[model samples]
Target: MAIQKEQIRTALAHVLHPEKKVDIIALNMIQDIIVQDKYVSFTLEMPIKNDPLTQELSQRCERAIHKFIDQDAIVDIQIGINVSQQRQTPAPEPMGSPLSGVQNIIAVASGKGGVGKSTVAVNIAAALARNGAKVGLMDADIYGPSIPTMFDLFERPNVTVQKKLIPLVKYGIKLVSMGFLVDVNQAMVWRGPMVTSAIKQFMNDVEWGELDFMILDMPPGTGDIQLTIVQSVPLSGAVIVSTPQNVALDDVRKGVSMFQKVNVPVLGIIENMAYFSPPDAPDKKYYIFGQEGASRLADELAVPVLGEIPLGQPIRESGDNGKPIVLDNESPAAASFLACSANMQQQLAIRAATMPKDLSISFTEKSPSAHT
Candidate 1:
C-alpha cells in the first residue's frame, strides 16, 4: 500500500522526543506532510530553540516514511523551529509596494569576478525583452554595479508619486544599479547589514512593472550578501557564468554548491569567451580561453551547458558603448544570448511543475479584524 500522512503519523506517534519524552507527532512538531506523484516532501516544526536533534529528527522522519513507499521515491525535508507567539506575530505587509509584479527572479552569479558575469546578465536581460518578455535587471553587486554602464544610463533614479523610485529603462529592459546612486570615485566599504539593506531597497523600493523575469547580477563568491539575497528573494532559479579556464571552473563549482545548499534549482551554466571565430574566415574557430571548461564542469556536475559565447569584439564594444550585443540580433554573440534565454525559459517551466509548493501556515485563511 502507498504511504499516507495518517499512517505516517500513526507510526510516528510512538516515536518519543528525547527532551520532552512525548510522541513527536502528538507534540505537534510535525507541521505539514505532502505526498505528490511518486514524491514526498514535508516540513518539521521544532519546539526547542536551537534544538540539537533537528537534523536527526528530519533524517529519521524521511527514513521512516520511505519504508512504507518505494525506496526510489524522492523526499525533500525541511526543518524549522517554531518561534514564540510574540516572536511569530505577523509582520505588517509592506503597504505601498510588494514584489507582486515580477514573475521570475533569476540570479546571474559567478564563483569569482572577471568572468563576464555582468555582461552575460545585461545581454540575457536584453535578449529576453527582445523576445517579447518584459524584463528587469537589478545590479546586486553593491560594490561594483555594472548594469548602469551596460545600459548607458548615468541619470540617478527619481522618486514617483507613490514615493517609490522609478527605475531607468533602456532598450526595453528596466534597470536599477548601485553605481547610479553612488559616486564612482568613492568605494562601497559598508558592512554586511548596510549592503543587505541597499539590496532590499533596490528590490522593494523600485517601481518595476510587471516583469517576466528580474535578472540579479549577484556579487561574486558565496558570502553574507549572497545568503541574504537567497533568503529574502523568492528566486525562480540561478545561472552561473564562467569562462573556459580551470581557475574559472574551480570557482563555478563553489557557486553551484551554494545554490544547491539552499535548494535553489540551478537553471544552467553559460560559458563566456568559449572561442574566437574570425569574421574574415567565419568557419575558422580559435580556442582562445583554453577549451570547454564550462562544458566539462556541467557534465561532471550534471547540469546543462546553456550556450557558449564566443570572444567577440562586438560584445566588449557594445558594453563600453552602453548597448548589449544581444540588442544587435544579427551578431553571433547576440544569437548565443537569445538561445540561452530560450533554454532558461524552458527549464523554468519544467521546474515550476516539479518543485514543491510553499506551505502557508497560519490559524485561518483570512485574519480577524482588529475591532473584532
Candidate 2:
C-alpha cells in the first residue's frame, strides 16, 4: 500500500511545537505536501527565523512522518519564514557615512553553526590580501570569537592618540575581533543592544584605513546581531557557507532568504567541507556529509556555487595553528580558497558594472569629511 499525504499529515499531527503546544499541521505551518511513492517533501513555515526551536520541530516532524511511512523513505523538509504579515518596505540605504574609505564590504555568514564559516572568512580575507588587495577581517561573531585563535592574535588593539582603535595586523590583513578585547575564557552573555553597539564601534571607531575589502565574519543564524551588522554597513554582497548536508542546506535557504529580504546581493554560495579527500590517495573522493547538497540548494535558489572546498586535515591544522590554509601555497585547500576569492572579485566587478550609476556612486563615493 502506498503512503498518502493525509496519512503523513496525521503522523505530523502527533508532533507538537514545544511552546505553541499545537501540532504543526494544526498551526498551518506545513504546506505543499508532495508525496511520490516512498518520497515525501514539504515546506515548514517558521514563525521566527533564527529560533532554535525550528530545528527541533523539523526533526520531530521528520520522525513523525517516518513513523507511518517507510523508514527508509526520503523525507525532504524545506524551512520558510512566515513574514506575510510583516511590512514590505524597501531595505534602508547603505550606512556608508562612517565607512566611506572602504571600497567593498563582504559578509560571510551561515544559517547554522559548525559550518566552518569563520575559517572561510579568514581564508577569503587572506587570499584577497595575497592578491595584493588591502583587506580587513572583522570577526563579528561576538559570542564565539575564534578569529583570535585562528590568527594567533592575542593582544588587544592599540588605541590611537585620536581615540580610534587600531586594528591588529597579521599576514598583511588588518583584523578586529571581540576575542581581542575580552578574555579567552569569558562568555559574552550580552543582549541585542550590546552586540549592536560593539559592531558599531568596530566600524566607526576602528582605524581601518584605506581598506579595499572589509570581510565580516558574521555569527551564525539570522538574529539581531546579523540584522544590525547588515543594516549598519554598506555591504558589497554576502557569501553563504554551508557543509553539504541536508540540515545545513535547509538553514542555508533561510540565510539566503534573510539577505534577499534585506536587499543585499548574494554573491554566491561556497560549499565548505563539500567532500573529504585523503592526502595519501589524492584521486579518491569521500562524500561523508552527502554530495553536492549545497550545490543543489544553490541551484534551487538561483545562486552560483562559487567553490567546493574539500575536507582535509591540513585545513583544520592550519586554523588551529593560527595560520590560514590559503597561506600555504602548496596545499589543495589553499588553491580552493584562492580560486573562491578570485571568483568573488569577479562577481564584485560584475555587480558594479551592472548596477545603476547612482547606486554604484552611493557605495563608492567618499564623504568629504571622511578623509579629514
Q: Score residue 129 of candidate 1 by CA lDDT.
A: 88
Backbone clash tally (model 2): 0
TM-score of each: 0.72, 0.70
* Candidate 2: clashing pairs of residues: none
- CA lDDT of each prediction against the hidden true structure: 0.77, 0.80
lDDT of 1: 0.77
* lDDT tens per residue, model 2, 77-112: 777666432211222325654465688889999899
Off by over 4 Å in 1: 1-96, 358-372
Residues forming the 10-long window of minimal summed lDDT in candidate 2: 357-366
